[model samples]
Target: MMNKHTQVIRIIMIATLQLFALRNTFSQATAQRPNIIYMMSDDHAYQAISAYGYGLNQTPNIDKLAEQGVLFKRAYVTNSICGPSRAVMLTGKFSHVNGFTDNHSTFDGNQQTVAKLLHNSGYTTAVIGKWHLVSDPQGFDYWNVHPGQGDYYNPDFIENGIRKRVEGYSTNLVTDFAIKWLDQRDKSKPFFLIYQQKAPHRNWMPEPKYYHLFDSVQFPVPANFFDDYSTRTSAAREQEMEIARHMTDTYDLKLAFDLPKESQRGLNSLWTSIYNRLTPEEKQKWEEAYKPSNDAFYKAHLSGKELAIWKYQRYMKDYMRCVQSVDDNVGRLMDYLKANGLDKNTIIIYTSDQGFFLGEHGWFDKRWMYEESFRTPLIVKWPGVTNKKVVTESMVQNVDFAETILEMAGLPIPTDMQGKSFVPLLKGKQKGNVHDALYYHFYENQEHKVAKHIGIRTDRYKLICFYEKNEWELYDLQKDKSEMHNVYNDPAYGKVQAEMKQKLLELKKQYKDPVPEIIP
Candidate 1:
């Protein structure tokens, strides 16, 4: 006859042993999978990062991937806008298939995501920081996202379905939560994390610590800062994004903020709202940093091209300051991984959602299929796999992100996804270009006056069709890299233009995209 308590103790001991056995088995299985950390920043142009040799500013932390692993020179996005670019990468599909063609579209949350596919493959997934997608993240084990476009200073973050305000700069707070999640993740399972940055976006705001980072340097003005756009289309000449005419005094230049509410215009309210979001200490520090410069700008009374140049300098300095914090935090993250012994078994990637114009063509926002906006910065580090300090000109696009991650992790890519895996490119198996041509489409027409269009880019030529206006433009990269002169009517390019048009139509049909009836 056994006592009841003794019997219960025996059963409990058996279960505990079984649990430990299961844990050991899981750890052994997951140890073979490489951990992945994907870091993406908003509106960060390739020209701003010194690793690209654009000579604007230095980003040592971001440059580390290029130094240690591989740098992609011809990387681009399916759509060159914020929300659509992210959506395309997430679903591994084009904007039309995903139903998120622009900022106005909502992400279909019920659809399968790359995160969901990875989770099914036994990886613990987490996404922290800016998620411009309107829906709450699905299939991620943990997520803390900023609402809407996200404020740059003292912002609010929504964590695990609960909204809370964090008391620090957006970059610092986002990084803190990301590291904290890594510290708390299940060690027995491989992890995938997306560390999204909100810095270097429009109306740039820097951390108090980096306010004086670029004070000593006077950035050079771009050669085409005074682009006449005389030979361009109606959309190019009518845009409201020029630094000279569109960038307001208070909103962009930070000159004045004391105007009466009734007198201020729509853009003027932006300055007041951002200033109001800060705490007392933050507000004081911001005023201290900009007050002297603002006073000097007003007293100088600069006008015309000189005033435009002055505003460009102010904008660049502020934008670069924000970029500095992003690089600093990237260093912190890499350090953490190195210290934790995760560096050797992890794959690191650094990229932006899309490209941005830094005083290029005298424009600010990204929408057109122009080179500045079409080409994004891409750097990847696979610790023991990739060649060190290699630069590849493979024509990779953002839609390939999902399938690439899956292939790297040895997981099966879903058939619904439109992107093809570029793992062979990373493994150094493919010598020449894997893609013969790339297709592009833009849907939004009202914002910034960028007209809707479709185009194609090959090795030596580019062709664009503004179907709505029944117009076309062609560029020969070997001759006109600036894309200033439209060569559509030039008899010299007649054959090349026709070939690109046929290929563009073929790509549209292959990708299941609807062609416009008005196309020429």
Candidate 2:
């Protein structure tokens, strides 16, 4: 017979063993799974964010993510246009490889996507807003997207198969829908949610409530806000996206009217209708207290040079207003995550469809190989996974996002993806550098009149060759971050330029770029 002390010890040992076995099984089941929340803003610029040090605008929520995680100093898009960049991001390939080189180019829904891969690997995936790829969004279990650009108010959302017009601010409505989906989704499984916002895109119009948020302050002008595009190449000289020239009074951005003309009456009516829809106290304050000096200029009958300056001021003001609203919505989302206890487990990313030229090259829209339009802001926050307050100067491309997502979840990268994972860098592995160099190709021959160009950006310099113009422009980024001066033809930098050209040629061959005969 066993002694009483021995029997008690044996009972305790059995209970402990059973508990260990249950814990091991639970950990195994939960391992290799994480929740992903990818958020993208439309036409947002790297310079606009306070974290990037432009300091013209404030983005506290986005900056908070950077404070808590890693901030990528040099993040680029495959193509500098909305549609193609988005497609490249989804497919983890270049614009040429994905067959979406322009706004008009349609995306084949059958293509392999990060969403599909995540779904197949036992994750529930959903895309909430702005699917501009011109295809029925594939790989997502649920999708609610803007028709195109979308409306500031009373926007139409194509959810599943039905096109329903939702009456609310685009940003708020999109977020509400996203939160609803989060609330209703299967709690037992991991989820991948893409919350894309259409706010701050072209013709930056904000909701009535957000319109006057930044009215009291005068936004500072960019140092190169009045760039002449003189020292740059011929391609820069030929572009038509100038803030002083191309901004119109009618289309997307319209200012207040002093004395409504017959033509202005229609716009006035719309503004009044929008204003009247607001609460009585809100409308009273907007009409009586809020008076924009821009209205007086718009009401003036000026011609030639005076009119051009007036338009630039109006454009800048309205554009910043749109951005202000976007910043607010970003704050709202961050607050939701923190309040719900999802902040710690979730990884949040913020970026744009592509970089926008905020009058940097005297340009408004993107689709150029220039640095302002090519580079975008990328911020990632993963609690306990990424070190706090880290800034990685390594070159990272938008295409790499897909592979990085897979790697974060411990999933195998697809063979078709051209991008490599940067998860190791986030985890403090620091393999010297993330990329030796980055490649950029923009094939969209669009409204800007910029020709097809393929370029390479090394740590120190950028080399771009305009295929149609038969021209080359080089910039030494180490010395010239503004890219105000071109040194392609300078004899002093001849050796550096020549080496970059050869590297470009080698990359073209490696990436199978279809452009024939890289002109030296």
Question: Top model by lDDT, which number?
Answer: 1
lDDT of the structure predicted as candidate 1: 0.86
Each model's TM-score, in the order given?
0.94, 0.87
* Per-residue accuracy of model 1 over 1-520 as CA lDDT, tens digit each: 7699999999999999999999888778778889999899999999988899988899999898788877888888888998999898889999999999989988998998888888887999999999999989997999999998888877999999999877788998889998999999987789999999998888888888888988999888778889998776776787778888888777777777567888566878877887788878777888889999999988999999998888888889989999999999999999999999999988998899888888888878788888999989999999888758989888888889999999889888889888887788888887656567888999888768888888888878888888788788888887877778888878987888788888888988888888575454
lDDT tens digits, residue span 150-233, model 2: 766677899997899887778888888898888888776788999998867876765666556555555554578677778877
In candidate 1, stretches whose alpha carbon ends up further than 4 angstroms from where it belongs are 1-27, 518-520
In the predicted model 1, the residue pairs found to clash are none
RMSD of 1: 4.0
